[model samples]
Target: MMKNNISYIDKVRENILDHLKTYQHSETIYNASKYSIEAGGKGLRPLLLFTALEALDTDIEKGISAASAIEMIHTYSLIHDDLPAMDNDDLRRGKPTNHIVFGEAAAILAGDNLLNESFNVIAKDKNLSAEVRIKLVETISNRSGQSGMISGQMLDIEAENRKTSLEELESIHAYKTGALIKAPVLSACIIAQAAPEISERLEKFSEVIGVLFQIKDDILDLEGNPELTGKNTGSDAKKGKVTYISELGLNGAKEALAKKVSEANSILNSLDELISTAGLRKIVQMFAERDQ
Candidate 1:
C-alpha cells in the first residue's frame, strides 16, 4: 500500500514535470529554471497536498494545480538554500545542486523565477474556483514569506553559531521548515471549503507531522546511509548547525518524535473522513518509521 501510494505521487510529479517542460526554451533563464525543477526530491509536499485533498474529497483538478504550485515553491527554496551564502550544499537528490550547475547569479534568478511562476501556475488553472484560488495564493504567500518560512530561515542561520533554547528552536522550526510542510495539508482543507473545525484539526495534524518530520530528518543526518539518503549525512554536525538532535540529544529527540507521531495518529484516527484515505495513514507511518 505504501509503495503504491509513493508510485501514485511519483506519477503526479512526473505529469507536473512533463507539463512544465512544455514552457521550456533555449535561454539562460530556461536553463537555470530547468536545473532546479529537474533536481529531484521525494515530492512529499505535493503528496501531502494530494492526500489531504483526497481525504476531503476536493476537486481533483484544482488540487493538482495547487500541488504543483507548492512543489515549485519548495524546489525554489532548495535552489536558494544550496547557494554559497546559505547551506553551501554541493549535492542534492544525487545530483549537483542548482548553484553548482548554474552560476550563483543564474541560480538566484532561477529561484526567483520559480517562486513567482508558482502563482502564475495557480492563476492559470481554470478548474479552480475564484475564491479557492485567492485563498491558495494567500496561504502560500503567508507560509512562504516574511511571517513564515523566510523568518524561520533567518532564525536558523543565526542560531547556527550560537546556543539556542528549545523554545527558540521550536519557534524557528515552526516557521522555517514547518510552515511549508503544514501549508499544503491545511491548504487542501481551505481550498475544499471544509468546516472550520475540520480545517483546524487538519492544521494541528500537519503541525505534529511537520515537527516530527524535521526530527526524523535530524536523526537521518546522524545515522543514515548516504547512498540511500541521497544527500550528505552528518552535514549538520560537521557545520555545527543547531537542530533538535543537537539540542535534545538522540534519545530525547526520539522521545519527542514518538510523542508527535502518537498525537498525529490520534488525530488521523479520529477523523472519520480520513479513514478511507489509506495513503495518508501510510504516509504518517512512513514518517515515523523511516530510517532516512
Candidate 2:
C-alpha cells in the first residue's frame, strides 16, 4: 500500500476514535460503549466512506459524522457478536469483551446504546443537509438492520452444523458483512449527489470489496497472526461455520481474493477521472494482503 493512503486511513480511524470519546456522556453504559469503540479495529467502514467521499470530490467534513456513526455501529455489532448467545467469544481486539467487563445485560445495553447513538450522531450532524441525513439514516438502517447485517447474522446462525451452498454462503456474508460495507460507499455517493451511472458502478465495487473483506477474514482466521488480528484463529472451523476457506480451501480462497482485488481495481481505475483513485486502490491492496 502507498504510504499516503495508509496515512490517510490511519488519520480517519484516529479521528473516529476521538469523536467517539468526545461524544461520550457521563454514564456507565456510555463507558461500556466507549470501551468497545476504543478497543480498536480496522475502522475500515468509516475510512472507506470518507475516502470515497474524497474521491467523489465532496467535502470530507460532511461525511465525518456518518463515518464515525458507521464505526460505532460496526463496534456495536462486534460487541453483540461476542456475547454468550452468539459467538461466545471472551476476547476482542486482544482485550476483554464488553460482556466480560460489563454484565451481559449491560453489554447488550451498551450495544443497543451504540446503535441508537449512531443514528443520533447522524441525525444531529448540522454539517449535512436534511435530505442527505435522511438518506444516510435510511441506508444505514436498511443495511444494518434486519434486512442487512442482521439477516446475514441470522443466516450464519442457521448455517451452523449444516452445509451451505456457495450461493447461500455468499448470501449470508452479503447481508451480515456486505450490507454495512455497502452503506458507506452508498452514503458517500448520496452525500456527493453522484450521477446514477457513477453511483451504480461504485455500488458494484462496494459489493465486491464487501465479499472480499469476508474472504480475507476467513483466510486470516485460518492463518493470521493472533498478535495482529487480536483474535484467535480457527473459530470458524471449530464452530462449523461455512467460509470461503472451508468451501474453497486455502489456495482457492487466495485466488478468489486476488480476483476480487483485481475487479475492485478495475472499477476504481475506471472512475479515476471522476475521483482520485489513489486512496482506494491502495486500500484494495491492503485488504487483499492484510494479515489481520
Q: Judged by lDDT against the true structure, how good is candidate 2?
A: 0.86
- What is the lDDT for 128 in model 1? 78
Query: How do the residues 1-292 of candidate 1 rate in per-residue lDDT, one tens digit apiece?
Result: 4454355556556655665566756468677777666666787887787777777876444577777778888888988998989999998877888888878998998888778878877787788788878889999889999988999988899888789899998888899889999989878887778888888888888888889888999999998887767789999987778899999999999999989988888888778753345667777877878765
Best by lDDT: 2
Which one wins on TM-score? 2
Inter-residue clash pairs, candidate 2 = 152-176
Instruction: Give the range where candidate 1 is weakest over 10 consecutive residues by summed lDDT.
Output: 1-10
TM of each candidate vs. truth: 0.92, 0.93
lDDT of 2 by residue, 1-292 (tens): 2343335555545655565567767478877887887787877887788778878888777787788778878999999999999999988998989999998998999999889878888887888889889999999899999999998999999999887788998999999999999999999999999999899999999999999999999999999988899998989899999999888999999999999999999998888777788878867877788877
Candidate 1 has an lDDT of 0.81
